[model samples]
Target: MGLKYKYESTSRRDTKELARNVRPGDRLYVIHDVSQVVAPLEDAQLYSEFIVTKDKAPFTGTPMVCSASAHRQVGGTSVTSLLVRYGEVYTERPVGIRNIAEEPPLLPEFQHLAARVAREHAADVAVARSEAASSGRRRWF
Candidate 1:
């Protein structure tokens, strides 16, 4: 099973209520797969020129907005309710794209990177064992 970190929405809807309702250790499945139509960024020309011209752009590089909806699952199958976690909110204008990379890092990606390193180490050990077996040498582990 794939593991994912939970992100709570700042919306004042019932989903936020559910998050608040759940007790610590209560099993909760986060369902995040709903598509809402958003305006394409490529079609946005009003602020594009300024962003391209300015050295220190204030706006987010993404022209298209994304509407992210979240849901809570009580059991393995049932969706308890829906909530709006992230709306298509725009960032401050005129900001450069580089600024996004400079922002604080996400914890989930860091954990994933560490896990990948561990898997690589394990694979290396397995390869060494296979080589030792073929060469008539005892494997040291």
Candidate 2:
């Protein structure tokens, strides 16, 4: 199956309600893809050339200095770009690209927190679930 991008919009009211309802151990899953929103072009280019051409770009040699300068030029700083530019070269082969997976598993810590929160706010879950279901969200899952 092809990758389907899912977009969710939450109002401030809804977010506040959720936050208020949340318990200490409640599991929170914050799903995001920085690369999808912002391309780390400089980093990508730097790595591609370094790996394929077997030569270090000036930026690759002194990543901190290069990143500071790049950020000034680009008008934004990106950690992904910095890592790609300055990170140690990996010996492992890159995995082949595939369709983005839906419902990727939450981290163990998050899962535990979620379970605890869900249990504590069972009533809230029903309410939230009902609201979510009724809100007519465009589902990609």
Q: Write down the TM-score of every candidate.
A: 0.24, 0.21
Identify the leading candidate in terms of TM-score.
Answer: 1
TM-score of 1: 0.24
Q: After superposition, how far is residue 20 of candidate 1 from its true place, in Å?
A: 43
lDDT of 2 by residue, 1-141 (tens): 211121112333432333233232222222223363365421222211111111223452311112121223221212223233333222232233211332344767689899988787887767777777899763332
Tens-place lDDT per residue, model 1, 3-92, is 123324454443344433433223332222223345332222222110111121134221111111113321211112222323211223
Considering summed lDDT, which 10 consecutive residues are worst modelled in model 1? 48-57
Candidate that scores best on lDDT: 1
